[model samples]
Target: MITLSLIGIGSGNPDHVTRQAEAAMNTAEVILIPRKGAAKDDLAELRRAICARVLRAPGPVVREFDLPVRDASGGYRAGVEAWHDAIAEVWAAELADALPEGGHAAFLVWGDPALYDSTLRIAERLRGRMPIEVRVIPGITAIAALTAGHAIPLNAVGGPVAITTGRRLREDGWPAGHDSVVVMLDAGQAFEAVDPEGVFIWWSAYAGMDDEIRIAGPLAEVAGQIAAARAEARARHGWIMDIYLLRRAC
Candidate 1:
């Protein structure tokens, strides 16, 4: 049987990597890194840096594989499912080749595996194709980091908060009964779609990382500023991972 460890190393910062995640990293015989072309190579580099910090000498055999791009021609959900299938195939082939004898392998995931991240779901796809068992080591989430970066609590006292993607937040507008919402995986400033009349926003790009940038204020006042900042950061870095919390006045 092939044992796979989905280790969350947090978002970008090596200091956020927990001892449990580090221990899990050392225990694996193979480590897989996904390459997302030149634009996002820093992601793979961060994973490597974390492994370098924790792995002992004569450590796990590390391998990098090109990640498949999501094909948007089939619509969002269908395209994501197809993309996951493609990723699973690459994973299965890489593991089979790396560990012909069947052993432990680990994939370094950003944030927690159980959060908005999909590494766990992709790993589940291997169950039918190979004899596999999966384990998770949780780490700090972008939400946790975002809140911490802003020195605010995740929710108000006895208030309802919802977590949703940028696409959903943009298309659905503020969820019906939610007083607060956390948005992730936004391709752009989805906040523009919101009414912004009585809402407040706390936005962060690369939260908890060394080069983190954050902006916060009444959405009406700072929405355009946040959009401009986000655009500048993304242009300079070639890529950006961001999350935000929005709260409506009581």
Candidate 2:
């Protein structure tokens, strides 16, 4: 049996990686890093840097594998499990090649595994097919990064906050009765569909990263600006990860 450790590396900053996370990485027999093509090669590079910075010379066997991204516009929803299953297969094949003797394998995860991320779910799928033990080393979350970067509280005093995806906000509309909402994994334009009245937005792209960008203002005024900036950044970097907090006028 292989011991699979899911180590959260935090949002996008090397400093965000905790000591515990580093310790976990040092102990693993094999560490898997996913290369997301050329556009997002920097992400993989960051993982490499983190490993190089934390691990001693002749560290755990580091291996890179191509990561399969979800098709955002897959026709009529082919289902998430379909995509996750494919990822699990890739992971298994890579691990079988790297750790034929069933040793410890570490998966470096971005952001917290329990929040909005899918590494845990994919691991669950792998467990169904293999005899592997799973361990999670929690790290900082993007939501926390967004809030801290903006230097603002996540919720107003005694008020409720709803955390959701851009798709939900666009398809379901702003959740009623929630004065504050945190959105992650947005398609970068969902705020356009929102009712701008009384809404304030704090938007950040690549939050907590070296190339981080931030914009904030009344939603009515900055909605277009955010969209344009997001598009330009994605074009410039070939990829972007962003999060935003929306609060109704109190």
Candidate 3:
């Protein structure tokens, strides 16, 4: 049986790794790291760095695989499905090559595996192909890092909190029955779509990393500033991972 551990390393910070995650890393027979090309080389580098710090005795062998890019030629959902299938094939190949005997394997996940991540879904595709058991090690999420970076609570006392994607926020306006929203996987500034009146925003790019940037104020006042900073950061680093929290006055 193949024991696959999906360990969350938390927003690209070494200190964010928990002791339990470190133990899992050290115990695995093989660890698979994905290389998402030059544009996001920092991502793979961060995973490697985490392994270096956590794996002390070097019992587990580390391997790198080229991640398949989504086919933009097709519609977004269809393209993502195809890309995930390709990734599953790669994972199967790596498992066979690395763990011919079928022992424990681990993948280092950024942030947490359960939050806006498809690793679990991809792993489910591998279930019937082999006898596999999945384990998850939770780590700090981008929302946690963003809120902590801004030194603010996620919700007001007795208020509601909503977590959603940038696409959802843009396509659908503010969700019903919620005053605060946390937006993730935002390629564009979705905040501009919402009515800025009486809204406050806390935005952070590269949260918990050394090159972190934060901008927070009344949405009306700093929406442009956040956009400009996001553009500059993406240009300078060649890539960016960011999240933001928005609250409408009750």
The top-ranked prediction according to lDDT is 3
Cα lDDT tens digits for candidate 3, 109-134: 99999999999999998986778899
Model 2 residue 192 lDDT score:
88
Instruction: Tell me the lDDT of candidate 3.
Output: 0.93
Descending-lDDT candidate ranking: 3, 1, 2
lDDT of 1 by residue, 81-131 (tens): 999999999999999999999999999999999999889889999998999
Q: What lDDT is reached at residue 178 by model 3?
A: 95
TM-score, candidate number 1: 0.98
Give per-model CA RMSD.
Answer: 0.9, 1.4, 0.8
Question: How many backbone clashes are present in model 2?
Answer: 0
Any runs in candidate 1 off by more than 4 Å, and if so which?
A: none
Each prediction's TM-score against the native? 0.98, 0.96, 0.98
Error of 3 at 175 (Å): 0.6
Please give, for residues 33-151, the per-residue lDDT of candidate 2 as tens digits.
Answer: 99989999989999999998889867899999997777757653575777888899999998888888899999999999999988998999887777899999999999888889999
Better of 2 and 3 by lDDT: 3
